[model samples]
Target: MHELQALGKQLVELPAKQLVDIPLSEKTRDAIVAARSFKHGAIRRQLQYIGSLMPKEDEDAIRIMLYKLQQPHKDEVRAFHQLEQWRDQLLLGDQDLLNELAIKFENFDRQHIRQLIRNAKKEQEQNKPPKSARLLFKYLTEMQGK
Candidate 1:
């Protein structure tokens, strides 16, 4: 019963577009939509109502679909973290890693990277804004697409 309420809370948090993808009954969907417009105590009561309605639905299927919907976001976050790690490593003068990146990205421009790194280093030493570092990140993002 509590688990159902928790699932109901998760369902309510989903955007309308995502809610459309989940297989929900009209009544449950209506309840969720209504809950979205409610104030605090009313929303809590609505969630309890939704939880009560959850038992009739296939819990496993809904859970699976929810996981599937969230997976792409998780993957994107992981990739962004990897890019940040790569950027940090490059800034630390990882020549071997830079060489590896050159091989990995066919469009990699070593000279451009060198210029960016030099500018970034100079900016750091001079206490200027990290304009080049941001450009490096933007370049890396484009490189990632290819």
Candidate 2:
């Protein structure tokens, strides 16, 4: 079936270390490893063979494991977007936003944040590199870590 082939393809794409982490049988692992080195038609046939073997294995469990592996990357991207939103809000010269940040971050350096905002705005106007914006992002990230 197409779903089985797709699962086989996913397995082929996984790194060896990740494959090891999954609860695959030794036979399935060996088949996948061998398939990795095959060329063109041989690789396709090997993948189909792996697909045939999938029914005997716990296909749902393998898919769940793959999803778990990808979850952290999604979390990181979401966090980065949140940081960008915060940076943009601060750059918009909203004093209330800064107050909210100060309240949230306790030891937030108000003077440094204001200075970075000014420099970032100047850099944007002059079409220069965003050195100050990067500094601001780094500061915010560090504060979040704490």
Candidate 3:
């Protein structure tokens, strides 16, 4: 399995503690951490590399950015397609300008992820059953798949 798919699968299937047991090689785990820790063109590069490892998966990791950023569905999917293109490489012609956009977009993505975690924890706390971390992980992981 490619690192991207493995990480994505882990993000979805494994609980937080179990995620650490997903058996990723150190390099693959490092790559996963790197990709998640920063929002940049590296995400595409990492996806491509992961896809390369798993020849069966040519599909790039599009939702990595979208899910992490918790962006809403805009008028059309093209907006997201274009945004990913901009991040992956400046299809826009200028590198420096795109770098600025990447930074701002990355910041938004980070904030979105933080807010999601906070909201989920808050909701869990108010629930009749009182969600556990494992349950919270399951909810988060499942939602990201969509």
Candidate 4:
């Protein structure tokens, strides 16, 4: 019963697009849609009603699908962090770091990288928008694909 309610609550928290992807019976889907308009006690009751309907569906499969849906977001966050680390290293490290990047990426444009680093440093010193830093990140991402 508690598990059902918990699943119902999770469903309520999902976005409409994702909610559509979950394999739910017509009755359960209608209950979920109706639950969105509910408030306070009524919402709680609707959630309980959804929970009561859970036993007739494949709960495990639904949970696994939700977990799968969330995995790509985690991967994207990991990729973003990796790019940030590389950008920071490029900004702070000496010439050897640039040389290392050049060796790692065959298409690395040394002159352009140096230009961006200089502009980024100037922007930082002036407390301006990090235009060059963003460009450096974009360049790195493009290079990574090649």
Which one wins on TM-score? 1
2 against 3, candidate with superior TM-score: 2
lDDT of 4 by residue, 31-144 (tens): 998888889999999999999999999998899988988888998889888878888988995678788889999999999998999999999999999999999999988987
Q: Which stretches of candidate 1 lie over 4 Å from their true place?
A: none
- By TM-score, rank the candidates, best first: 1, 2, 4, 3
Better of 2 and 3 by lDDT: 2
Q: Rate residue 51 of model 3 by lDDT.
A: 44
Encode model 2's per-residue lDDT on 38-121: one tens digit a residue.
Answer: 999999999999988888889879989999987898999999999998998899987998999899998899999999999999
Q: Against the true structure, whose lDDT is highest?
A: 1
- Candidate 1 pairs with clashing backbones: none
Q: Please count the clashing residue pairs in each candidate, in the order shown.
A: 0, 0, 0, 0
- Steric clash pairs (candidate 2): none
At residue 106, give the lDDT of candidate 1: 98
Which is better, 1 or 3, measured by TM-score? 1
TM-scores for all predictions: 0.95, 0.86, 0.27, 0.79
In terms of lDDT, model 2 sits at: 0.91
Writing each residue's lDDT as its tens digit, candidate 3 over 75-101 gives: 336554554444333222344644465
Compose the digit string of candidate 1's lDDT tens values, residues 53-123. 99999899899999999999999999999888888888999999899999999999999998998999999
- In model 1, the worst 10-residue window by lDDT is 81-90
